[model samples]
Target: MNLPPVNIENIDIKLRFGNFVLNVLYVKFGYFLSSMPEHSHSQGSYELHYIPQGKGTLIAQDQSYPITPGTLFMTGPDIIHEQIPDFNDPMAEYCIFFEVLPGDSTPAINRNHIANDRLMSELLMSTPFWIGTDRENMMALFEMLASELSIQSVGFHHTVTNILEIIVIRLVRQYSLHTSSLHPVPLKTLDDSRLLTIENCFLYQYPSITLKKLADNLRLSTRQTERAVRKQYGISFSEKKAQVRMSAASRLLLSTELSIYAIAVQIGYTSQEQFSNAFKRYYGMTATQYKFKRI
Candidate 1:
């Protein structure tokens, strides 16, 4: 995969590729003045964010969500989102952007339009589409991310990459199990094989996703899916998804240096308050409190 043209604009977005056949890039995770305005890159590259401290909101097109400590977000390329701070305390987060190319015999993930930009949308498909996190673990992950970012050692790329995979699988299992409250769809409807297929695609990128394209891909109604998932799992779908998303986010926060706002956008939230409200509802303490307690 072609990395964005090298420039100071992305100097911190460490890119590691070439003879290693690697395409991994990461953003700083903590303590810096956010110099860039709220805009987005048009390049189609997969991205993930982990928030460890402070408060911020993510703005995307017409949507907004919060980015608080212990929040982890992952989305495909062309997702136009920007970070918004809470204006209270220092902001901290860590993020990674990567591309997965197809391999032998396995149908290759589409690369023809990998660069097309539209902005990642969590609203395309129906309920149980796979996305979620928890509150307590989310905070723990956030602290871990901050520590890792502070070290910033050589070959950190390898370490970061491995961590990223673990985050991905945690996310996959969470969402695959309908553990996200941000996705709108309830967790009650995730039992069918179809829901699993959709989430697998989102995580593994097994099938190419069209830009802002989600229609007729699901076989359940919002109510039906929610009901079914709850019946099967014995918990509301939204709660489960949020629990999962929050947990993954915590992991990211504990491991990266990306700012809080960036991490908010990487997750599905559009602003900081939104993220905070959701987080507090789940964890009781504020993002700031969680950060301090961890230290």
Candidate 2:
């Protein structure tokens, strides 16, 4: 009855992982379940969309990005966008739009001019974004949001806001992790604390990383550094670095509509072909195939 009250386990999991609580204040419905015409977010309210089935192309601002099942797309007050679904495949999505005042900590509105203002153009060029997630974690977040919104009782807004805030923060972390790896490093590590700190930095910033540099930062020999990671993760440092880079690469291909070239640069590959080859070897599929698969 009542669709079994949705799934509350998802709510608990999301809450446990993110420590984010939100209340939805309002919602605007869409008319086209089978088709979405050209549209835009030119005002203050924002929209969060999650696709569960099918593939499509979304034109956000002036740039177009492909979309697929499990895709999450968010737009803020400053942008305009349209949805172009792949009719060949069935599409299922959960989306909602709402507003927050100035100073609100919302990703859709809290970005810099380059991002919030012209993200479409930036996305078109090669600026990387991130959203591919650990499946359990991602599912928990989305299911919780959907459950919170399904409520017809009182005081829903506050709960939805808390959820949205938490989700947006996680998305921001994803973006920071993916982008920083492509960016630069600020300092070197010299101790255990510093090493952990450096590791966190690499994870967040996506710095070009190496064992030699890590050992130099920590004043250890390269072999010592390799031994440490091997001892802890049961994998060689080389394997670990490759694993992390691959993880980031997979995220870029999925969460973003970035081209193979753009995604390559973000994940430390110097060229698109190199990235494609490595991705195929590791994932057993080309980046494009992998991206469309929604794994």
| TM-score of each model, paired residue for residue | 0.39, 0.38
- Runs with alpha carbons beyond 4 Å of true place in candidate 2: 1-32, 103-136, 151-161, 177-295
The TM-score of predicted model 2 comes to 0.38
Q: Candidate 1: what lDDT? A: 0.44
Best by lDDT: 2
lDDT of 1 by residue, 1-295 (tens): 1112111112232222211111344444444245223322212234556666677766554366666666666554234355656665545655554433222232324543222111111221211122234432555543444445556588654665555444544543344332222222222223224433333333333123321221234455666655543543345546545644565345446546656666566666778777778767777887666655667
Model 2 lDDT, residue 171, Cα? 50
Model 2, 104-186: lDDT tens digits are: 33335344643543432233112222334233345466666666667735765567556665665555444433222122211
TM-score of 1: 0.39
Determine which window of 10 residues in candidate 1 has minimal summed lDDT. 1-10
lDDT of each: 0.44, 0.51
Off by over 4 Å in 1: 1-22, 32-36, 105-159, 176-295
